[model samples]
Target chain A: MNNMEKIQELRHFLARYDLPQDRPPLTLGHPQADAVLGGGLRPGVLHEVFAGNWSAGGFAVALAILAAGTKPLFWVRPDYEAMEYGAVSPNGLLELGGDPRRLIVVRTRNAADALSASADILGCPHAGAVLLEIGGMPKCLNLVAGRRLAFAANESGVTVVMLREGAQAEPSAALTRWQVSSAPSRADDDDWGNPVFDAALVRHRAGGLGHFLMQWNPEHAVFTTHPGAVVAAPAHRPAYPQERRAV
Target chain B: MPRLPTDRLIRRNGAPSKAPLVVSGKSGNALHVHALEARAARLGLYKGQPLANARAMVQPLAIVPADEKADAALLEAIADWCDRFTPLVSLDAPDGLFLDITGAAHLFGGEAAMLAHVTGLIAKQGFAVRGAIAGTSLAAHALARFAPAIVPAGGEAAAIAPLPITALECDDKTLRALRHAGLKTVGMVAERLHSELSERLGKSFVTRLRVMLGAEEQPLTPRRALPDLMAERHFAEPVVTQDAIAAALLGLAQALSEILEREGRGARLLEAVFFRADGKVERIAIKTGEPLRDPKIIMRLLNQKLDALADPLDPGFGFDLVRLEALLAEETRPATISFDHDENARRQIGFLVDRLSVRFGYTRVQRFVPQDTHIPEAASAAVPAQDRDFGPETWTLKRCPDDPPRRPLRLLQKPENIEAGFPLAPDGPPKFFRWRQCQHDVARAEGPERVAMEWWRNPGLTRDYFRVETKAGQRFWIYRDGLHVQDQLAPRWYLQGVFA
Candidate 1:
């Protein structure tokens, strides 16, 4: 068989052994990004967002997705993340359109504990969305853990966002994976303009990869698109060359 | 009962039948006897004597290591058993138990009969017990340990006169000083002038003497709260099965519910105390989220608690008395429910939370309550789920629909320090910030929402917070501590929380 045929056969085998990914999609409110994703972001399935250079952009996107639903959000974070980076600023998120009152924060000691809590939160139907934030992809979050999260999210129909910091795009059971970075906000009379996000669809199960420049309009509580803008390369880049990542 | 360290371990394995048993603790270079069994006492081997010397005096002696925890647990169990006689049972540890029979004694015929019944019950369990009844706990304690088996009413002073002054439960130093002062017995100590005794032994010695002489009655502080209402059932034959216990609990709960209904009250906390025939006692307590009067719910909760115990309630031969008491109760009136299903669902959630908390511990199951505070970490407090009704007032973040909120959905427990590069002005948001070794250039910056320290609660540096979005879309709530006021310390920046 040709390479394409062999790959198709592998996908069929994986579909049977692994959890089902068919679920209603959640719109990210960006047309181009949604079109590339075949529909929109799928709910009841795990989705990973890598914080490329800037982690806040990825986290903002996660919150933006969560703000779509009115149910309570359970955010499980590694304790070290609070120590290393910073904790969630309730005031900032509130201003960003996510209700601080409906958020339940669960802090675990490590990435493994965070993942476990994420799986537990996904099983609760009352949790509108479950966000698990970790510094990097720990070894414990293997294929098995990913499948378990997918299964739980599917059963409870809760959107699960796995926010990873300084993490490369890796293959997993996640319905789609994206890389997000902060973009220059569109200028206005006000000093600090609308929050713009440079988001790229790095991986998708159904296969179309695309990028979109998104801006958060707090007045309407929705994302407005900026026509075709990618994140500018960092001025002072890392000493080591960036390694090619697997989709 | 204050046991010499050694007595605890030996008591658990049952009393040493033949050999003289002595509990020993290490003293200086050799093992010293801390407590002596009756046989050892009879053999003239007293407590605090070295083991080598004790062994030299007695040929065959049984020894065990000291265990205070096991002794305390045993004391608690025995106290539970005594609850069958009177709800007022408190620990007189390391070896004694105080049972305030008072008005309860008449139910068992009289005080003498009640004492005999208790002694008989303990004796049946293979334990040697010396019990006494008096108007006060102090008199009863002294009489039980140092004087006769029973002190007659209004004859407490005369009855305890012959007992040695050492029966005052004083330290060895005081005992030695009392002996040196030629006060050999209770009678001798009582004869001395109060001023003279207080001058030499301090005021406590005079107070102790007064309490023991029945001059100043000492009240008994019951270990468990005196139940608001109680109902108990005595079996003609001891019950050894779990089913029997459940039936007894249900019966008691129903009877207690009737009494509670008359007063328009419901039980918040209920305890089922089981007194075993073998003198062992097992207690199961249930706490409800709201006041409850339903006998069915009470019985179900008790059963759940009993089943959830790691060390299952052992009938230990058999239980003869099952007493159910409402340790805590609250006023209640029938509420008219708009929808029965909603009320039922709410009750079901409460019951599920209570059961889970009881099984896995309350700390593991928690709920958050918002507080009025600007210090991000102090905005919300997590409390045990069961304590949700501890206060009547509920707090939510106050924000107008049209106005933007200043708090994030999730706040970090502790603010983290980060390195950043900013303008020389030292007042505005940073142009670039480095957090967790990742640098982010400013793409968007918002105002410095200054949150002054709660000086009334805690004095702290005034913080100027800025909502800054890094070049990569990462939003951070960074704050510069201290103000730009002249003569103020240089303000340091900290990453308080994230926007997402």
Candidate 2:
């Protein structure tokens, strides 16, 4: 309202760009997925992955590894996730080329607790990435909670990947939305191969959407896009086919 | 504290009646007086007296039932309240406390002022109080019973000499024997030779006498561990508002940090004690991953814990005293410079872990540490992040180079049973299986990998494991109960975990 206060506000606005949180996008290494993502998945924002089983859970982990790099990755899950879907194994993570030593797991009692814990985890700039796995559609995960999480993530510049299982897509403040599931591996009968994903970029705030059948190379821990397998879909609406089970 | 049972009752309700009150309990088959108020003791009534005889001697007697449990709890509560005076307060059983104020007397001016302050406050709460200060606990215990006076150094003998021999508080048999030996006063008992006293009263009694005479010293066993460092604030008027409580805590934290800085040490476990004006106490504790000395960080963790408390801290009538104590401490480690911001980031992560642990629980926030073993389930264990004693962990990949992950990403604590049958071969992997009410047709399969149990472990069943991929693309690692033997019972199948 006054000239001096206006000048101070302009100075505060000018100071924010100097922060190191404004960095380049992290490439997912998949040509099709990266191009649709406008180069790649951007850091310092909220990303949501919707799926029914551990197949999508694994993909969420792969994205977390990309965002986290060599830093600590905190995975917060409600206790119901373990009871129904099984516990998250350290050996499984080690096999997937993620550092188990740099991982911290917080198993909260319910979705409310998981959300609060993730908020705290995201506030800490030291943590490179935080994965929050919520089970059912609890009332606590409303738009306000989503907006609060997004604000915290933006303030600290830590990437947050939320794995929502067994719930319908709801409106939120996430930057990108994904629908992922497991796809058959490209190996013969006697050889069980690497993890393959049917990842659909349903919602992108800054770019268009695309669906790619990607296979993960666990030895290198990156996605390898298969050429000529783009599924025909529209981006104006939420992606993924109707009549899908549960999620 | 002498009539604690009666005092507790009288404190709960005002004095019930004009008649003297005695707490009675069952001794043998008859009711006997267990404890009595001062008014009752002044009459012919005394402890251990049968009710029938007491009622026959005095008219209009009042009797109350004895509750040992309530009495002990009250004593413990009083001991907790006494923690404000000294951290080394120990219970002296049924009705007394021993305060080891070896170097703490100066805070209350001197021994005389502290004694007067403690007894005066306790008496203000409507409990009869008597206290004394001496060179040793035994001397103090004896003097407080007969005469409430402070005994100076090297005056232990003269101070207790003129008192009756009962002041020594020896056994009744020993007192009767001492009286029979023409020793009515402690001075008369002290006149005998050491050998004569030991021969008559026994060696333990003589040692007790020596301890009482201040010729020997004994250490007091405190009821709780003594804090490494402590700082407290005493309010002239009790504080009830949130702003006042916060200000008090900030002050105490600053004081504690100053002390810590002078000693070049930091605290690992910090506790806050709130002594309420209504004689109730509340304690809150927080633990850290590393030795922390910063006041701001300490207050932040405390605030986080306070917010996450199941029932928020209530200022019942307001707190009269607030004390901050470091229950555990360690020497501060100098920060090491790294090529990147790794060191600073690690410290920040540690603080975050501490905050989350306080909000959730210590066991809920954990890091995976690789164990040195061959067993699948025992390969890694989640240790609480607050404790750094687990040491370094280097994960060794179970799979060979360029091969698919042999281990499942998420291992269940225990395996669940599933129905499977119709393998390509008798010992081959199952063709199809039913799990969680869904039937999955196996398109690709690998295994019959036999894993025998170690000899040192419990004789668990040796399992033949398999990794099967369902036609829908979900991969599962399942195992058969035992080996394929001739004429053995049919082996059951179990689903262990799923591949990510």
Candidate 3:
């Protein structure tokens, strides 16, 4: 057969085996980020949102995207994460536009239970999305577990976000991997202005990657693009001195 | 309807043997026979006889302690198993079951065939029982225990006429009184004048006599509520495969849905029972958030429940009958023909929650419900998300978006202790605080919102909270546990929450 005919035949074969078309992407509401992601982050697939520094910025960004959906969300974390790193604050989450009433917090004894719960939550169509916060990726969440999570998420058409802390981007079955760190707010007065995050599209299954500075506007209830700064060699270090140390 | 009675169920729970066995228990100071096997009874060994006397009369008699709990549990399990024959099964106390198979006997061919089937099933399970069918439970019970025969329709009086006076289940005093009066058999009692019997034996004897003769009706109280709606199918051949079970469930669901639709009602709770040929019954229950009459949704929920069961639903020796029952129902009106996409979407969400809760335990899924208390920790509670009433009433906040929220989004379930420097003023916020060894210098402070403890509810020290923003732009809600009025008592500060 000619090259064009062979190519056409291959395309049809790929189409037959492609992921289910029922689940579409959930737009992050950030233009630049969405552009980098081709269109938007695909729902019904596992995605990792990690922070080089274990700050609240990464979780804030996750909550911003989660707030756009009308259905309830499940946030599964290890019980120790709550005891040691402080629990989620209802006021803080409310300020971030995440309705605390619509959020279900599941605290498991260990990472394995959290991941299992995450998979369970993903399979629940009632849950618009699920955010799993793990201290780090353990050996138990290997490719097999990832595939199981992916399959469950896809079947239910629910977005699954894994909030990883102090972990490197490891090889797994996740569709996209992001690195978020706290960035300097634009306001000068000490009123705790809008929250900003230096976000990087570290990995993408469909392939284009980029970095951007995103600001969460509580007034507008959306994430707006900020002027990107020249990131340091480590990729997530604070841009200015004042932003370096936040407790 | 048939009723089966046993003197003692203990002998049936443990190992079965043909040898004469007697279960002994201590009555006051004397050890007496609590129950006996059929062979023991044939050998003239009776219950309530002193163990010493029984042993003296019959050497090498098998004796075991009576366990009433175990016997009762076995009886309950058997009653559950009897659900295959009829859903209306009730315990007759001690060791008896009243099964109201009024409309169900024909499913197994006929009443006679169903009785034979039950006796064979119970016998195979190593339980020796005598079952009888009569118009009334009193006659059925009397025939079951005394003669172990079926009393034909309208033959209640004839059935008990030959039974001994002891079959009346009266006290020994009453029996002695009856024997003294020359009434040894029910026939003699039935032949007595009603006025004479009442004057001589008291009103109670007359009542018992009338009940035994079917002149007075006694009702049977079932263990479970009679289902609001039920649909069942009896397989000609036993169905063992998962596909067959699924198909049977779908058929039953369809049948049940039609009934529900016709009644203008919908089911909220449904139970599916798999009655195995070996007399084992396995049941799965599913709950829905809203009234549902769709067979497809019911089937899908059941499928999820069956898959998620910890103990696989084993159709032991294959199931002969499958039944679907709507345990709870609600009045439902036909939906208005509209193009409201949001309603459909919300319905789908509710279905998803129900399905998820079934798979991963209902308690594992939860929703935050706002409570009345002002205490930050007690302001909201996590209740099961699948709770039917988890709606806007418990979650919607009264404050508008423009109004500043008095509470934080995330309040620590337990306030973490933090070391804070003494403020410049008695009610001012701390200048610096150290939490988890990380120091934060407060650059701006909001207020000293003094909240007093509710006096009626274990009143304690009042708290002064402040919304403090650190130099790095992170806001934390810190509170001083006690007031600063006492010089000797220095209030300790704790970080209670954080703001975005």
Candidate 4:
């Protein structure tokens, strides 16, 4: 075909189908438990997660958001050291086919500016998600500021994730509040290596709650499902000897 | 009255047609002319006599030359001084001023009170002045010259009735013609038919008369209008030293900050003027990296700016007045302070960058932003350091992986063309290449990463880039032009950058 004909063909091919619009909904590690809770966390609402011994769950949630096709994720974590999180590298999300330019890490002066910037980002329609590290926020930004930020997020169609430092009993404007903790999946012996405890979802929006067992593969920088697993009721006996004694 | 000669000799041998000055051959042979009829009567001189005979009749008469420029300059100074009452003062002519004191009247109690105040002030300066108020400037001008000091609204014609034809400011020839025509007052001229008036003396004369009677409205040009954002501080006593000026600036900055905070905005550029007591003024200005309303921070920035001023603030006498104005403003959200040490360090870095930018010039400091185009030169743009918003760039090297790959430490400002042959080209690495009369040899070589220019822009050339290691283990990025064609010129080579 001639060059002009080839150009016309390319244009016709491009106009054949519209681009895909489906995006994966947020995957709250314990799917069954989250399903029991009201249809997973509300799509575009603020969710507050209080930090515990293992801060890795928060980092996992951040990656999940990016993997869900959320473009331009604003990470406003002042106290959480990005380097320690193991995904602070510029191309950390490249394995997921994510655009490196879409990830923005803002090193704010303090929790105040971080919260303010998070609110501003949430109010902007172009933003896909905003993660506010209000672990060290001043007392001034308590309930009132949180409600304002939530309103802004709702109006702009942006998801907000607040990373709290310590255990807080109540959340002002969070649609779903969860507390994450670490525990072993099972006591079964695996040939590969010793079974380490996978982070568990101890609390959720609805009354339902559970835990997931997973093994970390540092070499590939990812986590895989444990070989053998056991599911138990909320008050069931601990599977590990050490966990049972502690309980 | 005494009988006076109508014709007399002006020069030694000629008799002029116009009236001449009387002169006396004896007692100094002085020439004298009667300017005022009262003075001539007092001096025993007749009106129609020749100057030679009049001087013979009256001795020791004084002659004074007229000073027109000095009179105009004095009038201009009076207009400038009138600024104290209102900034909208304008000079009407050589001897008149049109002050638009509509809103300014209340500042001095009322309109009549303002008129009395201005007249008293000018009278104190030893000048004879008259002022009239009317809706239109033309009407005001005519009334101030011929009519009463205060003309009732819409009564311009009646107020100017008894005045002579001179009040119209007609030329000498026009005045003589009017007098010859027996039209002695402005009221008489106003009564004449408009068509007849225009045919006899042209349209301008009639137009001027119409304008003076409020038939048309005239616009007044003011001297100074209010600025967008201004803050002024008047000290109890004049200050001279730079320290005093700096202290006063703090107060002004606080005032400006309060206003900006109330309006939910911040200033980007600010200018400060010092009106010295000795009639001299000094001005200094500064621009901030971001819009800010913090007085302490703004004062600190201004202090650095003041230190960088080329001209020293001597304050020769003292400065009694200081004014601060905001030239540009923008809405900004206040930042919160963090307790984390690393985060604090980052904030400190932003401040240091702003200071260094102010000292080195904004354009000199730059940040790199990646562009989407494939062309090497079009892949990045250098933006002002202060204006850069920190974020990841979208574009990447075509062959490079999405990792922290090694890159050249320094990129040449511009590419240099070279001719490579023998050992340097044709499928072989160079043993030695001459660059700036210095020879360098290749120790290792990496492949040709092909990069093509954007063809849509214009006719483009393709490049084949290679990473070559020298004997010293220093790697250099070099590229070659389009490959050889049967009828085209040979390819050229250039060294683009060096990796540390």
Candidate 5:
């Protein structure tokens, strides 16, 4: 009976040092998508986003903004990536409902430098997430390197998003793998409207696969399924409309 | 040694010639002997003798052209090695050095012992060495050439009296004039009237003589600025293992941290110097974002730099001395335990930025600052994070809420030319376009948003921009140059960026 009491006391002491297991995941606000992802995108793990075309880079940026919340986001990219896929414009990020001031960019000389920088950034629990963009299958980003990155993220509770462009899918330690491409705008809607993407979940370690036609609402900062998913809150409708105006 | 050019050549080649070797250089229209080996000097090949004449004097002679660049580099390196002894070491070009050991003499014993120790160590490296300590640099320069003797204070006049006038190291013309005047020694020149000597030579020459005799002091300009604080270790036997070097660094860092803690300050720029046993020195330096005093942090930064070096540190013949110096020390605010999570997180992020900057570069780790300009590319600027003067100005996005992003998610370094046809409706976006070897039919378009260039700063034609989405849903931002009638040229279109 005395030993049991001591064991209980030790367990209480160790709980403070361990990571908080009750931290809620980030919800994308789309009911169906949230249900498939087991509530939302989990933190403290690695995720991979494969760009089906050049336009898919936008999908990766949107995900990062959602995961980062009010914290800072660190982006690491190689030197050649800027020339090939263009530079990340902070002005554009602001239009996508992200605070440009919260972004930090680390431009590395090569893929190896980018990997090393990502590891260092992930070790800091203060950082919200890291976006690492690599164009090709560099030898430095093999399975071992991926595992190391995953370990760092899990240890610090900093989400990592690896955006791969122009490369084949390889084995990785990511919790979820996605293939993203831009989708045609709805014909009846306004020509100039929010961005839409056809995202397919090819691999999920904890759940099943899914294909989503998600539309990003910049004003509300949430994703909405187009066509026949659900009736969204009207932009013109005031809140508590059923209550009559006293004036 | 006076024959540094010849010595440097022999040491680098690693093999000596069977015949005597000499370094030659062009003097006027003829080749003259710059320096020669000991054997050549003994065979009566004096410097300044014509190379042609030396060949006739000695049947077997090996001659090499003088390389003053390599010789100067070697002299500079030797001066770097001497830095371990004292911080104040100056270059005496061609073949000599000036070491001002005023208060440093007692550290290596007395004046005489220090001189003996220095000359002995240099001699072991296969080079002839001579050193002396005096009250002034000029007095010591004259004494070192004559012999390795330490002159007593206030006895310079009597001690330099018997030395030849060549000890002054004056121009050849002055030496010739003195020789012709029947004054071969310094004492004979000192006996003459000051006015008479001044009238013959110049006021500067008289000053030189006075300084050499200890009547005045000539200051020596040191090679580097003195460090704010320093710690060093000298090994009795050369140390070659990595563990030993690391242990030495750890001890030195601890010593430095204790010193810094007492003063309530930290170092911003730290330098580590390694002195090899064979007269080679390597200096590695690191810069921090904030004043840092922790020994562990300093060790980690140094380890990162050493690992990333392109050419790894070479411990040839092992290292005899290692030194850690704080080049720039600054007062730091005492760190208080933070109760707020956000503040603690910010501090930790600042440290991460410093480490990344050291690995890549300061310019590579950057944060975006809003620029007060309307030009697309000039709207925002990326500056090094360490600079930390970010203005409170926020990015003013152009698009309205709930509308598509008018700006592109990613912008090319510069606009690229594209092939497109004129729209059916005038002053509108192109109907069809070809880009990157793919043809796209425009399904929707928005714009003709006219943007004028900054006429006063960089005058150019105005551009009409359009946001177009293809049938495949890929969006592009394209702009047409000024009207063909106004610019008197063909209307051209360019792809500026891509929208997500």
Candidate 6:
């Protein structure tokens, strides 16, 4: 009957239609390391990767992640020199199907801003995956502000990967943490041969410590086990009765 | 009494009231009508006498000065106070205010109540006030100044009937014409036919008269409409420190986030308003790189921006109210978490880089993106620090014709000139070279890679680049500028960039 009444009626009608739901998280598989993850990477969760001495292994893993799909990936490299290690040698990543359009690389100035931004990207629903390079060893990142990112990722379903350069004593809230090291190459004549890598799944929420030797095939852009590659000794191997010593 | 520009008329008790004469005297020539309560009062200096004649009547009459600016400022304050009732309030020149309280009346419990409330408030503030409700601002203004202080709805005509012809607020010339036409009371002129009156007085007379009679509607322009989303916090105890302001900011940001999340949208721009105890408002704003609804992230960004303000947060007395508003918003999809360990790690790293870049300069942090161009320098661009692209795989290692035979380890920001002579062919490196106050002999040489500048651009310069290795095993990327024609000057050599 009146303008107010009309507006009220319209508002009630609009209230009935629900808002559009968010897009499902995008899945990505390391072409050379499918078996390493069982399937492909899940859309939403925090994953940690430890790089020991060999920086090239970390580069290869980063390349593998980028080449996995067309989804846009954000790469945040805090250390300037470390970025050169990945971009200078074009062997592993250049050969993979890494699209520049889908990648964003950022160099942060300080640790605090870097950490905060890492959390922000995890909270963003539209981001396919965010790659952050933490120069030092892993620290307690589960502060009040830090936990917001985990909650955001869980709520919005965006995957976040924290790459810590050195070793740490304590564990983080990451769903999975894997230590990656470079293994000897197995190729004889091919210029673009497969590079074998030792990936130790130190911690996993799914309950098992999955330590397996994987080979990264540059040509196939996938990860598989090499026949002759040696796997590291299991962490939980029971100490032999003779080897056990009293503290 | 004679009219004086600098004097005001006040009752003996300083109270405003309706009277026949209340003019104040200004100049010595001003005619003061009367005086009371003194020896000058015994001199028959009545209040209505002309000032000049009053001087002649009594030389000792007390005279008080008037301040026009003070009066104007006082009127403006009253207008500002009127804003509480309706945002559409404007000055009506000299001494009146026009407020459009149409739809706003309901908020104050109807027109009569709102009018009574405003009048009561002004009266309590020690000011004489009058107000009227009419269809048009001009009509209400005329009614308030000339007719009674209150007019019932639909009584505009009857209320205006008894008022003098001056109630029209016409110019002196028009009033004189109306007086000459024997039209004294507004009711007499209104009683005549509209066309007849217009023919007698002028077209404007009929128009103003019609507006006064509710025949036309006048629109009111408001200052600003209420924002789409608003969050406010009032402190129990006023806050005067930056820390307190920041804490308030956090609360506002959190509240705003909830509202934004419910709508499944994010704000691109946000503004925080700090309302001080003394009624002054301080505002701070921030623009996000992307639409975001996360309260903590927004608070961080806003904190950075606030820290950049030149004025220190001196709340003076203190800030009693803080309001946060999302000025611009966009629809956003929900974010997802990563399950893969490596992927999740990468996401976290990306976030870290973005935050660092915001604090530092984006240019300081960058990603190397391979370009499709054939020129060596054009092969890649340094992308700003953030999540962008790793670049196309096809162009990552594609060798360009303009690439040096042996790329230098580093590329200087700009080329430095060098003097050298080539012992080999034009495409070969120099046998001897001098650059940066140093001279070296080339034991080995590499072929030159010609790179032509973009001719379409202004001041384009072409150069033939070469990678030369000296006897000491030092590699340098050198270029010869200009063409090597027979008559042209010898090519100028300069170093640009190096390769590892």
Best by DockQ: 2
- The candidates' DockQ values read 0.19, 0.61, 0.31, 0.02, 0.53, 0.07
Q: What is the lDDT of residue B202 in candidate 4?
A: 84
Candidate 4 lDDT over B463-496, as tens digits, reads: 7777665543344567777754546545567776
Give the alpha carbon lDDT tens digit for every residue of B1-500 in model 2: 77888998888876867878878889789999888899888987888889888888777888889999999998899889888888899887788888987788889999989998899988888778788888888888888888878998767777777889988888899999999998998878887898999998899888887788788887889998788998899998999998899899999999999998888889999999999987788999988888877999889888888888898889988999999998898899664556677667877788899899988999999888888876677788888988753246778998887777888877766888888866777887788888889898888878877878776875678889888888767788999888877576457888988887
Which clashing pairs does model 4 show? A110-B338, B21-B51, B22-B50, B22-B51, B22-B52, B23-B51, B23-B52
In model 6, the runs with Cα more than 4 Å from the true position are A1-247, B1-228, B234-237, B277-282, B307-312, B335-350, B361-413, B419-445, B470-474
**Clash totals in order:** 22, 2, 12, 7, 0, 73
Cα lDDT, all candidates: 0.70, 0.83, 0.73, 0.57, 0.83, 0.58
Pitting candidate 1 against candidate 6, the one with the higher DockQ is: 1
* lDDT ranking, best first: 2, 5, 3, 1, 6, 4
TM-score of chain A of each: 0.81, 0.84, 0.79, 0.62, 0.82, 0.68
A62 Cα displacement, candidate 2 (Å)? 1.2
How far off is each candidate at the interface, as Cα RMSD in Å?
A: 4.9, 1.6, 3.9, 15.2, 1.4, 9.8
Error in Å for residue A221 of model 3:
0.6
Pick the TM-score winner. Answer: 2
Q: Report the Cα lDDT for residue B301, model 2.
A: 85
Per-residue alpha-carbon lDDT of model 5 for B366-444, expressed as tens digits? Answer: 8898887777777888988866633365688789867889888889888888898768676678898888888888888
Error (Å) of candidate 4 at residue B111 is 7.8
Worst 10 residues of 3 chain B by lDDT: B1-10
Candidate 5 lDDT over A1-247, as tens digits, reads 6999999988988654333333578898777667777888878778899898876788888888888888888889999999989888989888887778888899999999999999999998988889999988999999889878878888888988999999777878777777887777766554566788877766666665567778887777788887623233332232223211311
Candidate 4: where is the Cα deviation over 4 Å?
Answer: A1-247, B1-226, B235-237, B332-353, B392-399, B402-407, B417-431, B450-462, B485-492
Q: Mark the regions of model 2 whose C-alpha exceeds 4 Å error after superposition.
A: A1-22, A226-238, A241-247, B27-30, B161-203, B334-340, B389-391
